[model samples]
Target: DIDVLASSEDAEKVMDHFSTLPTVVDVTGKGHTKTSVRLKGGIAVDLRVVSPEQYPYALHHFTGSKEHNTKMRHIAKSMGLKMNEYGLFSDEGNENIPCSSEEDLFKALGMTYIPPELREDMGEIEAALENKLPKLVESKDMLGIFHFHSHYSDGSNSIAELAEEVKRQGYRYMGMADHSRSAYYARGLKEEDILRQIEEIDELNSKYKDFHIFKGIESDILTDGSLDYSNDFLKNLDFVIASVHSQFRMDKESMTKRISTAMDNPHTTMLGHITGRLLLSRDGYEVDLDKILGKAAQKGTVLEINANPHRLDLDWRWVKKAKEMGIRIMINPDAHSLSEIAYTSFGIAMARKGWCEKKDVLNCLDIDAIKKFLHN
Candidate 1:
C-alpha cells in the first residue's frame, strides 16, 4: 500500500495531481481528508492531508499496527492528555501540544522515541516507557552480508563482480552462498564448481586487501534431515547456510526435525529462510518455530532474516524471539543480482523492528570480529 501525507491546504492539489497520472484508473473523495487513487493494476494509493503540526502524529497514526497506537493513546490518557492523529492536547484546557517531529511527540510524553519499525506494540511501548528500548541495529551498522549468489549459481553477476560491488558499498566482507548441487533448477554448483569458486574467492581475497569473501553455499537439507554435501566438503567452505528448498508440505514435526538435524551438523554455520516462505505467493512450510529456535540456541547456530521482500523469513517476530534465546541473527539479502544487494536495507528494518542490536547481528562485526565469529 502506498501511503502519503500532505498538508491540508494542498490536499486538493495533491489529490488532483495523482488523479491525472497515466496509471491512475479512478479517483474518489477528491476534496476530503483522504483520497484514494486506483491505479490501472488495481492497487489503491491513499493520501491524507493534515496540518504541519499534525504530520508527525498522522504519520504514526496511519502506520498503526492498531495495537501500538491504541496503547499510546491509553498512556496519554493516564497523563490527562488527549491524543489523536491531529495532535496531542491537554485535557484540562484542550490546548494542543506542539510537536515538530515524531521524536518531539515522544519527548512530550516523557518517553523515549520509538522507531517506526518498532511501533508494532510488541513490548515497544513498555520498553519506551521505561527508557529501556533497544538500540536497534541500523543500516550503517552492517559491515557485510551473506547468502547472496554469484554466476556460479543462478546469479547474474560473477563472484569478482559481486565482491567488488559489495566493497564499493563500504562492506568489509561478504559471503558467497550460491545454491548447492541439489538445487539444480537454480544452476546449482556441483563439487567441482564449488572447488573452483573457492579457489577464485581465495585469489580475489589475495588481490584485495580491503575486502574478503567467505566461501559459502546454501546447502539443501534432504528429507532425511541431512545436509547436501559431505562433512569434508562442507568443512572446506568458510560457512554453510542450511535451507529447505523443497518439500514444503512436510508436516510440522517432520519439518522441524529436518531443520533441527541440519543445524546439528558441525559444519552448519547458519540457517537460511527458516520458514521456506515466499511472501504473497506461498505459505511457509509447517515447522515448530519454538523447537527450531531451541535447537539453534543450543547449538549457537545463526539464523537468517532473508531480506528478500518476497520472503522476509526468520520473520521480525521470530527475529526478536531468536535474539532473546541468545541466537545470532544474520540479515541476508538472498540476492541473485547486484541491485538486489541493497535489499539488506529492508532486512535491517525487520531486524530493528525485531529489537536487534548491532551486537546481535553477525554482519555488524568488522573483519577480525566476523572472522572470529565464523571460525567459531
Candidate 2:
C-alpha cells in the first residue's frame, strides 16, 4: 500500500493533483483522507493522507508485508506498548511515543533499522535484533558488468562502442557474453565469428588502457544437458555464461538435470537466468532450484542475477540459500542495448532484497580479483 502524508490544509490539494494525472483512467474513490484510482493499465493505486506528526508511523505500518507488521505488533505487545499507524503508545494509552523517522520506530522497538526490501518477514526482524543484518549490496559497489551483447550477435552496438559506453558509465571493466552459435534466432556467433570478435576485443583492449573487456559468450544449454560449444571452443574465451533459451517445456527432473550438467562444465563460469522466468509474463520453467544451487556450489559456478527489469532471475528468495551453500553471485545487465546497461541498478536492488552483501557479489570485485576467480 502507498501511503502519503500531508498537512491538513494540503490534503485536498494532493488528492486533486492525483485526480488530474493523465494516466489515471478513473478515480474510484475519494474521501477526507483517502483516494483510489485505476491507471490506464488496470493497476490500482491508493493514496492516504495523514498528519505530518504521524507520517513516519504510517509509512512504517503501511510499507510492510502483512506478516512483518503482525510480527512487529506482537513485539510491541510484549514490550508493554501498543503500535498502530498513528504511533506507538503506552499500554495504558496515556503517552504517545515520538517516531520522527523509520529509524526512530525501529530503535523504539529495540532493533536495528530494516530496509523495506527485507521486511518480508524472512528472518530480517530476528537478524535486526541480533544486529546481524547484511550490509546489502548497492549499485555503487558494481565495478563491472557481464552478460551483455553486441552487433556480433543481436545487440545494437559494436564491441568498441559498447566498451566506450561502459567506460563512460564509470565501470572499470565489462564482459561481452553475446549469444552463442546455437541461438540462430538471435544471430548467435559461429566459430569463425567468435575468433574475429576475440581479435576485435584485443584491439579495443589495446586502445583503452583504463578499461578491460573479457571475451565471453552466453552459450546455450542444449536439451540433453550439454553446452552449445565444444570445450576446446569455450576454453578460448575468458569466461562462459551458460543459459537455457529453448526447450523450456522440460519437466522438473529434466530441467534440473540440464542446468546441473551446464554447471558441471569446466569452462562454465556462471549460470544465467537460472529459471528462465520473465516477470509478469512467463513463469520460469519448473526445476528443483535446491538441486541447482547444490550443484553450483559443488562446481564453484557463479550464479547470475540477470539485471534486466523483466528478468531478475535467481530470485531473491534463493539468494541467502545460495550464499549459505558457498555460491557467489554476479549481477549482469544482460544488456542488448546501450540504455539497457543501466539496468544494473535494478539488479542491485534485487540482490539487496536477497540479503546479499558486497562480499557475496562477484562483480563487486576488482578486475584482477575477477580474473583470479574466473581462472580458478
lDDT of 1 by residue, 1-376 (tens): 6887776666667667767889988885566677788888888888788877789889878877899999999999999999999999999999999899988999988899888888888888888889999998988889999988988889999988888899999999999999999999999889999999889989999998888899999999999889988998887898999999998898898888898889889999989999988888998989999998998898999999999999998889999999998999999999899999989998998898889999999999999998998888
Measured with C-alpha atoms, the lDDT of residue 25 in candidate 2 is 93
Put down candidate 2 lDDT per residue, 1-376, tens digits, no spaces: 2344454557888899987899989999999888898888888888888888888888888888999999999999999999988899999964989888999999999999999899999899999999999899888888999988999899999988888899999999999999999999999999999999999999889988778999999999999879988998888899999999998899999999988988878998999999999999999998999888988888888999998999999898887789878799999999999999989988898889998999999888998998888778
Tell me the TM-score of model 2.
0.96
Model 2: lDDT of residue 298: 82
> Relative to the unseen true structure, what is the C-alpha lDDT of residue 372 in candidate 2, on a scale of 0 to 100?
85
What TM-score does each of the candidates earn? 0.96, 0.96
- Weakest 10 consecutive residues of candidate 1 by summed lDDT: 6-15
Candidate 2 Cα outliers beyond 4 Å, as residue runs: 1-9
What CA RMSD would you report for each candidate?
Answer: 1.4, 1.6
RMSD of 1: 1.4
